[model samples]
Target chain A: MSITRITVLSGGMGGARFLQGLLHGIAAGTVPGVSPGAEVTVVANTADDLWMHGLKICPDLDTVMYTLGDGIDLDRGWGRRDETWSVKAELAAYGVEPTWFGLGDRDIATHVVRTQMLDAGYPLSAVTEALCRRWQPGVRLLPMSDDRVETHVAIADEAAPSGRRVVHFQEYWVRLRAEVPAESVIVVGLDASSPAPGVLEAIAEADLVVLPPSNPVVSVGTILGVPGVREALRTTAAPVVGLSPVVGGSHVRGMAHQMLTSIGVEVSAAAVGLHYGDRATTSEGVLDAWLVDERDADQVDRVRGAGLACAAVPLMMSDVDATAAMAAAAVALVTDRGSVDGAR
Target chain B: MSITRITVLSGGMGGARFLQGLLHGIAAGTVPGVSPGAEVTVVANTADDLWMHGLKICPDLDTVMYTLGDGIDLDRGWGRRDETWSVKAELAAYGVEPTWFGLGDRDIATHVVRTQMLDAGYPLSAVTEALCRRWQPGVRLLPMSDDRVETHVAIADEAAPSGRRVVHFQEYWVRLRAEVPAESVIVVGLDASSPAPGVLEAIAEADLVVLPPSNPVVSVGTILGVPGVREALRTTAAPVVGLSPVVGGSHVRGMAHQMLTSIGVEVSAAAVGLHYGDRATTSEGVLDAWLVDERDADQVDRVRGAGLACAAVPLMMSDVDATAAMAAAAVALVTDRGSVDGAR
Candidate 1:
């Protein structure tokens, strides 16, 4: 029996939670157990990392990292648990510029080491590797790019000092609370930065690709910005599966509704499925199967009409066990497809 | 009737400790009770700042800042008092490089913000200014230069692969415990870096200049490496005074004896006095007056023979009050000189 390697493209909290469930499911021997154990690869988004007070902060990557490595602050949804703030207070006393962002003391040690390594000319992947040695995130976590690519939002603030401010994703989410209307979203440095080492290979060789209930526009979308990433997904023989972040016209977490509206996509699972339509479905891109919640069963044919395999199931990942069940369902769908292909 | 401005050329621990006493003495009305208060400008060494655990740790400046701002760790001799080590434990768990240097959770915050600001394009001087605003050390403290000048010690290693090695100052001090005999020391990056803002004016206008009892080979030597700093000290008309760091043949703190030996200077007040010599005393280099401990009173003629106005006082700053008394004596020497110059 050959190993079935599962590849996941993830963002922050939601994706991390789902991956946790997937890992749990694998451990419980539920999700189509593969011989020689299952290999998991997480291609993470670095778009959310912003330089605040001179430290590189990647919210999404760290979330997935801490969650998988068992170092995450589950209560805060970001940073490490049992963190301190001595350095923050000291910095505050210095009246250092850009004092808005709060860096915890324990959290600061990580940033200090990361910044130090970066200054010493280590790439983000190598630094990530060095950091992950302790967390052992259970899977190989790769940043979309070793180079910097910050996500920026263009706001129509005609009255402001800068007619349009290009704020980093973190400033939009963490500082501004996503209150300002985004006229356009831009991922800076995408044109220059290539995908990290082994990223495309992992995606290409995976038995199945999973896009855990992450924000399609920023989370998965930013990962797609990496050169060769989306192309690998489109051309891979493996079936691609995505769990909808939208449930009952609302996001599970974060201000995904505003982001969806900014990109002209409706805040619905059907719209989300259509947004990532089958290459054959709407001449948009590639997506083999689209899964929605049981509540949105009425939108099943609409999803099928988009020219892809569609399924409506209990998609609420209520707990670790439930999340594994969701992952199991997706795996079952891909396995069923594999058998059909084998017969052909 | 007018406020007198005092400028001091400082090294690290001893210099900073002396400043602490100077402040205390002035506060207690021990130093010529002038109205509108006295202003002090401290030109500090950048040589001791090392890139440890990937942080630009300026031991001297931070010592002065913490000491004056009332945050100095009383027992540790470096870093803030009451700092936690949870971050250090975590960093160690990750098997981070340079594990020997202890960066407390509280201290790590300072490094994080400093690294961040440095990445964002602010010069070290501006960064120091911002840092001092919080510490409010009550003195205008400035780095000798905005340039990167790392002190590297050339060591003759016999037990290993290479017979000779250039180790960073911290590696030599903290890691190797300075037991390894040093061949020579190099202040890297000093050739291009300029003296920080306000350094020259402070020296030119100063009524008195004092070289605090810091390490002559590295701490003060590094400051002199900045192109114009030594020249400014050389041409200043104010009487220059220095308290000897080497007392009765032993360093009060640190491995100054080892450093002095490496630099080919004997660990004695007489050798340090002659090292500064008449060039620092007669017309322009550093001073007209030199203060040695009462134990070295026999060397008064020896110092005077080198063309410096010499005085032998009980120079042991054993306590805060004693330190203040020492500072008062330095001021009295300067005042007497100024009065004599006025008569001329």
Candidate 2:
């Protein structure tokens, strides 16, 4: 099928980067069979969201919005561009807890607007839509779920403050730097959450589904954990292709190795591709094709042997052009081998 | 009586300035008989407080805290010193309403901390106290009432779709600049709101109670409008004395004239004194004495003619010493003639 409608299951930084390249590709008419008029829908993971100091903060959704809208702090790769730290400093001075997270002043404006809307009886999905009227991220951006779903990391605590502390994902990643081993990744409230408005519909109506090299466990993985999402992928007539976040034996960025280890998944491209499995082999499985970096070429045959069309390409998104090339490769991989007949 | 506990029913700017000078007087041992260790307990008006963008902003309470803690913007006489306006600008950029309030970046920190605590099931008074632990305002600061009480102004709207407009006190004062004629000053929920913890107790145990030269109608007047507060003042053994915010037939600062005019009280020093009324004459009266500025000294006798001892003093609070001198004159006004016999 000619690429027209594309849906991406996304996380924060890595997912945002891929979407940027994909948008660039669409705009430049360079993303394989995809044209400039192609509509992209991003279903961002809200499992990474947390309420801090009474403000609802959606790191993944904001990342996709700010990054795509050209408002992201380029250096930080998460918060707003030209952000100030006055609010954060004042918060620290007041000795409010969880001071490790750097909440930029410019970023806080988004939170204030969001929190106000939420308090006024608007759900998270509606709030995101209202906020997007400003950012104009181009693509239809929808949160994974309107219900509160927080990713908590279980870690061994020798201090025994609570025997073993299950910290919020941010505290684990930002504060602890994911240095300590995580026993498990707990996605609280995700199992009970229904897909947010337009989420399942976006997936169902899409020509293709792309999983950019986001954290398989926390980012894209948690998004899949939401009920009806994985089911939509299984039931959709469109092809589903994924680019491996795991390059060679580790993540290009972030602590995917730590998270994968915690979740009892192997830290390799082939292992991750197999973990997603083949739609032909398992009725519950969703992947039709998987792309890995050139360095992981040796694992391509192994990934293919598991009943999914697998390809090795240069997947480092150094810039928009390079990332667009990766996106193009992803589109070509799915189009060539993940066509309607290729499902067999 | 050795003045140990001093309670002041205060508004924002004017009350804050008066308290600053009062503290200075106490520190210098110059307020008639008040010593260095004199403890001040301020009952601040919560009527001016509003929930903006999901944050509880206590203008008067914050004014007292910021002023006493030396964090206030001296030039603006409100908000934190050396403040940035990034949040305010961002809010405006997002097209959030009532952007005229000028919430400083540093000042927004106060609101955030307050909002967080309030969301976490703490009362406004507790949140204020928790926030004060940082500023160390050196006085017991109590919100006039823990309950929500908003001062809304009724305005004539000849051109309105509804033919009338009722705005929050901030909307009237900050946005409108109180330029439009206020039809009535309505203290919503005031009659239903009981005094906050330590409010009535602070009044009952005080050697002296002061009505700082804040906006008498909206600020101090609103605090007295709280259910138990006015009754506490009427029954307390402490001499209840007030200083005139009006000078030279006009307010020294702020919109006292407009609010007084809205409530049908004359916008003059003597009229304000009589408006509080003679404590001995009426069962509901609350003020034992009133002081006018030197500019309105001629009206002092007219105030005394209303069955209360009155005095004229320099009230411009131009500097700490001048303000301390004014505070001294106020203390002396109540101590000398507003003693037990003065009530009779």
Candidate 3:
């Protein structure tokens, strides 16, 4: 039987770009040298969506939406191109409460509509689907949770003895530029939020699960925070393959290195794999395969030592062709092995 | 007795500009011979302030604020100059609701603060005061009422035989551009909305009352709709003078002609004086003094015929000098009569 469904666990820019390339590759039927009909499903992080200026902003979701809809500002890597700010400037003059985060004019329209629809009783999953209908992002996009789950960082400040205060992820990432080292990272409302509709179903039904090189902590970690999500990943019959976000010892973008250090994890593919260790240390089994950059070939044994099968590949998604090679490698890892438990 | 205070009945744009010139001329002690320390209180029309894009946009108030604060876009004559629209563009791409009217970025910041403060339990009058503190729009700006008194136009549509549907003034003004002739005009909530703080006091204790050449029907008329305001204008121990918005047979700005026609009043200075006709037509009494444009000099007796002392003067308000000259003329009209009614 031919491999059909593919589920991608993605974060923001890096993950979105990778998925764009992957979708392109898949559409061209050259991703993994496979035939057409590879249904792509992406579980996007929703922890970055925040209400600012009386607008409901879903940063990650919008990034994905705009990127896929051909509306993304290629230069900014976020928000729409040719956007206006007549509204925001006016709001500032009125002495609006929070003048911190910047919300573009075109971006505000999205939030207003999303907020209106959500307020009118549509579940987030349904709303995402409805929004996707307009963009036709090609691949099915799913928010990690139908309910609210915000990622917050604990930072040291003079106000607390621990010098710590919790800030929304965007406040830490965008506003503060992640200057203050975080003591801990917490995904708020995780305990109550359920996996978005079709999320687990997509994971369980996929022939292969691909973890794009997104920020491992906030993106993938936030996704797994949803109830039944980690459980599904562990028990799903499909083999899971993850690309390392860390090519060397630093993140491709953002302040992920500081985030990794804050969480007491070394910025390395080996450390990341170990964090999601195999059955020996995990209540649930680890990833069946982890793709590491050729530069880190010497560290593959560390991943193998953790009982995770490791492959050293030129995992650098330098271009569309290069990204397709990486995606094909991921599919090959699962297809060549048939199945994690030899079920195939 | 020294002339201690000045009360001005005003509308947006034209009224605001005229007020700015008057304020400048009075403050610099250059008004073709007028008293110094003449306190100016502007009774601003709140009829055009509508809730759009979740913002309480007061066109009249913002006009006065921007003009007086030296932030007004002289070219556009509304909103700030050098504004951005990154937020609005983003909002549009996201398919936000209510994308009809444009809101600028700088403009939006003002709304955001206003909305937040309003949500935080501050009344609009206090909010306007706080906002003015930043712009320092010089004169005390008082809304006609603290309540939600919106100007609605009865439009004829296929939905009704009378084609009569009451819409917010902004919707009629900005959205439709007043293409449809108004069947009737309704200032909703005015019946219950009491005059804002300082409104009655400002009119009751003024040395001279000047009605800026604003839209008589929507602006000044809306102010008159507020309870006790008309009475104060009639019985105040000061002269109430009005400079007509209409010159000859045309309004300087807006669809004032259509609005005037809705109330069955011809679009002329003489007609506007009759619309504010003395106690015979309005218990609030008519103009104690009326100033007509040189082009409408022939209509001075027509205004006088409406039971008010009238003066044919140059009321073009081309600049500070001209506006100050016109203001002096209005004061002279009242001063020459030497107390039309001693009871007032």
Candidate 4:
């Protein structure tokens, strides 16, 4: 079966990097059963969105757009390539709060445009579409939901009356560096947020769906927490597959290990796959197959025992070619499983 | 008489340059009969204020602040000295409107702070005061009024249905370059605006009031149009003096000639002085003494005949020292005229 339409659930840096490789593999006709001309749709997590200095910032959406559009700062893995920080420095000089989050000058233009449109009553999805007109990020990028969904993390605080305090995910991740132990992950407004326009439709109409190696707890997990999003994934006719963010019991980049730990999920490749679960057995399951790294081959059977078709390949995305090979392996894994008869 | 508390009604570039010299002259003790430690208060014209790209831009206020705070671009005579145009370039690439107004990265920081404060329910005066905490622009800079006041110019547009078009002051000045013939000047909200906090008290308690070499019609005239502001000036106990922005047969800089023509005033030093009129004769007059330029020395007698003390001096603001000499000349002209007891 040839897949011409593919949908991917994404986060920031990790998801953006994975999409680049996937697109490269498809263009090179190396992703086993996928068409070279496949139309990719990205439903990105908005839980990491923030408002700073009165401007709305969508970190993940901008990451994907800038990365694919060749405007990303390659060294930093974010922001504009040749960005200036005059505005950020000036804001700090003014002694405003949250000076830790650096907003680049070139990036501020995007936020100004978005804030203006959002203030003028355009939804986040529409604003994203309008912004995409400039970046033309190759894929159809839609926010997970139009309503505000912020990820808040509860961390133990010795001085607090309750012995714990909740902080915005950006405060925890960007400011605090996610070093402190988090008591729980609280996704405010996620359960109440409806899927943004075209989100559910993209999933239901896709030939296949792939979950990139984004942060499972706050990224892909937050998207699934949106009302009707998990149900759409569970019932979609297309086969669903995912590559492990974890390899040898730890994430390669980002604070995914810390986030998973906060949500009480084990920091292991097999545990992450099992956490997503198998679509054939449970109503909550969404993935048809799970791909792990070669170093974690020992845990492949443990994931397979949960009724998910599992395989181990070289999942290290060192470069484009290497990541493309990982994408190819992921596609071949699902193709080799030979279609779960009654699941679809 | 040692005049200590000096109040000046000002506009943008010309006014800002004049204030620099006035302060310099006061510090150097070059101005005749003026205290070395005199406190200067600037009542800036807010009629040229504009809202662009969802940011409130007060051109005159920012010009005065940047110039006084040493952040101004000396070459351009406005904006920050080492400004970058990344945000402006990106905004142009985004294809948003009003691309004519170039907002630099450093300058946008000021607008961002101001916009954020204004959106949070603070009035323009309070926002300006808060911003001055950073700039510390020596003088107590106050907008003429806290109310929204915009200067609109009616230009003869043959293509318009009514054979004319009314454009914002910035559109006329910046975009159109103020080359076209202006039919009239209309100040929206000026009539309804009350003087900003401390504005009336500054005028009433001032030891001397100086109208700098700014655009007489749009800048000083707009402030005078604010109901109680003119009354305060007319009834103040201090001597009121003004320097001619016009020299010879035209204005030294800016589109003052075109603005004067729009209001049916002749573009000559003598006419501008007479337009302000002598405070001793008419209830409408606000000037106790008017100083014309040396180039227009022949017109000095014409102004003196209008029952006001008038003199001729070099009015060109070639540099700080030259402008300081001009400020001293203005101060000496008023001192030589002697006091008009009943008028004060």
Ranking by TM-score: 4, 2, 3, 1
| Prediction-by-prediction clash tally | 6, 0, 59, 0
- Candidate 4 residue runs with Cα over 4 Å from true position: A338-344, B338-344
lDDT of 1 by residue, A117-138 (tens): 8878998988888888878888
- Candidate 1 docking quality: incorrect, acceptable, medium or high: medium
Error of 3 at A194 (Å): 2.5
User: Per-residue lDDT tens digits of candidate 4, residues B1-344?
Assistant: 88999999999899999999999999999888889989999999999999988889999999999999889999998889999999999999898887999699999999999999998999888999998999898899999998999999999988999999999999998999889988999999988889999999999999889999889988889999998888888899998999999988888876778999988899999899889988889879999888888888888778889987877777889989989988887777777554221121
Query: What is the TM-score of chain A, computed separately for every candidate?
Result: 0.92, 0.96, 0.93, 0.97
Q: Compared with the true structure, what per-residue lDDT tens digits does model 4 show for residues A1-344?
A: 99999999999999999999999999999898899999999999999998888899999999999998889998999899999999999988887788999699999999999999999999999999999999998899999999999999999999999999999999999899999998899999987899999999999999889998999999999999999889889999998999999988889775778898877899999999999999899778999999888888889889989999888877888999999888877777777554321121
TM-score of 4: 0.96
**Worst 10 contiguous positions by lDDT, candidate 4 chain A:** A335-344
Better of 2 and 3 by TM-score: 2
Candidate 3 stretches greater than 4 Å from native = A33-35, A82-102, A119-123, A159-162, A279-281, A337-344, B32-35, B84-102, B158-162, B279-282, B337-344
**lDDT per residue, candidate 3, B134-211, as tens digits?**
898888888777788888999888787665788888888888888899989988888888999999999999988888
Q: What share of the true interface contacts does each candidate keep?
A: 0.74, 0.81, 0.72, 0.78
Window of ten residues with lowest summed lDDT in model 1 chain B: B335-344
Q: Each candidate: RMSD to true structure?
A: 4.3, 3.1, 4.0, 3.1
DockQ of each: 0.52, 0.77, 0.47, 0.82
Model 2 per-residue lDDT at A141 = 94
Question: Across residues B68-183, which tens digit of lDDT does each residue of candidate 1 receive?
Answer: 88888977767888898877876777677668886776676677667667867888888788788778999999988877888999999776587888888878988998887888
Residues B176-266, model 2: lDDT tens digits: 9999899998888988898999999999999999998988889988988888888899999998888888889899895667899998999
TM-score of chain B of 3: 0.92
